[model samples]
Target: MKRLFLVLALLSAGIGFYSCTPEPHFDNVPVITFESISKNTKLDGFGNKTDSLVIAVKFQDGDGDLGVSSTLKEDSLLYKTTYNYQVRTFRQVKGAPVEISQTISNSGNFPRLRDDNKIGPIEGTLSRAILIYPGTVPKNDTLSFKIKIMDRARNVSNEISTTQVVVNQ
Candidate 1:
């Protein structure tokens, strides 16, 4: 009778452990949420002072193909202009809204989250610093950014916009 009781206890413990394991369910297409945006002052490569807007975003991908290798060459599959992360800047001068031109390159690439070739779900926060020069915007002006990310499979994530931030303050 003791042997049968021990066996049943072990079986119940095993079932409990198995049921506690949680599996993540996410869409293959990437999804992103705006986390935060902050401003800082820093020196540029040219020894000039500049302001930086650090934008943080949380992302989730089912396949985890969210970034490109630094050594990978641009091809038809991944065009030169296909940046993994894209940021569009907008400014409001005294509450008047205006969209910045595309002449400024606010897009860049993020390192791959998973080094292995195997695909799986991934979720993390990505923070990027965008430099703002003296004339980037007027003093005491408010700025905001619209952000999106793309996976290696050319899957574009949902777009998210950051809250307004005062620059040159």
Candidate 2:
């Protein structure tokens, strides 16, 4: 009876560990969707705040191929994460709303790979924070954002846009 109890305990531990880890990826490309965006305003040395936007997203991949191949080389940094962003700032113009647009691709790895040789679907949430400097825009201006991600197969996820945010000075 003691031997049987020990076996069951070990089996339970193994299952718990497996469920917490990321599953292997199959051949299908990963899919990601926009979740939410919120601002983290902090005061600088001059007592002025530069907006830090936290972007949240949900992702699923049949073949867990969403991250870089390796983390040792310079090339790995380029393919690891495909966090892309497009921003538009709205100004209160005389007649129509004046707007400025900018596009950017983030660098570095997000560590979204399986640890074993198995192949299966993986799903999780990814969050990134970016600092936005309100250079020329006047106070009370508004801004919007569009974002997307890519998988190892170079499959681009559906683009998502954030709601209008007031430029807090």
Candidate 3:
């Protein structure tokens, strides 16, 4: 009985110590890290044969205000400039990489991560699919992408780049 009581006491003390641990501290500005990019290509649509790739990134924000509500309305000018996530594409040309013309808008908003009014740090991974349609670039082009995220406060996160990948393969 004494041995069982001692074990129980030790378990309770461990639980109490864990419960007293504080949350991790993070900066107010968002920070993002490149997680991965899908190597295998998938069909963009049911019937369409165009290839698509997915890029994933992990992000952390101290204030937990990292996304926007779909119902929120704003001026067209403001809306155009406000994007929760931005992705820039680069293609290998000769021996160097060049930024492609901004014909496709890969930047867009993400749903609010936290719904409650309570402010706290939050972190999560975000993945986005990019289409590699015909005529966009030469077939089997070597490409890489730069990604960044913005919090609801318009604080931009550090940019990160993904490994080079062959598209339309």
User: What lDDT would each prediction earn against the true structure?
Assistant: 0.85, 0.63, 0.84
lDDT comparison, 1 vs 2, better candidate: 1
TM-score of 2: 0.63
List the lowest-lDDT window of 10 residues for candidate 3. 40-49
lDDT tens per residue, model 1, 7-120: 999999999998895758789899999999988887778876678889999999998888886567766456567799988889986577577875578898788788887778
lDDT of 3 at 67: 82
Tens-digit lDDT string for candidate 2 (91-138): 446644565553543323455466674567877887877666656456
Point out where model 3 deviates above 4 Å: 1-11, 39-48
Candidate number of the best TM-score:
3
Model 1 RMSD, rounded to 1 decimal: 3.1
Better of 2 and 3 by lDDT: 3
Clashes of each: 0, 4, 0
Query: Could you give the C-alpha RMSD of every candidate to the true structure, in order shown?
Result: 3.1, 6.6, 2.9
Candidate 1: misplaced stretches above 4 Å?
1-20, 43-49, 74-79, 93-96
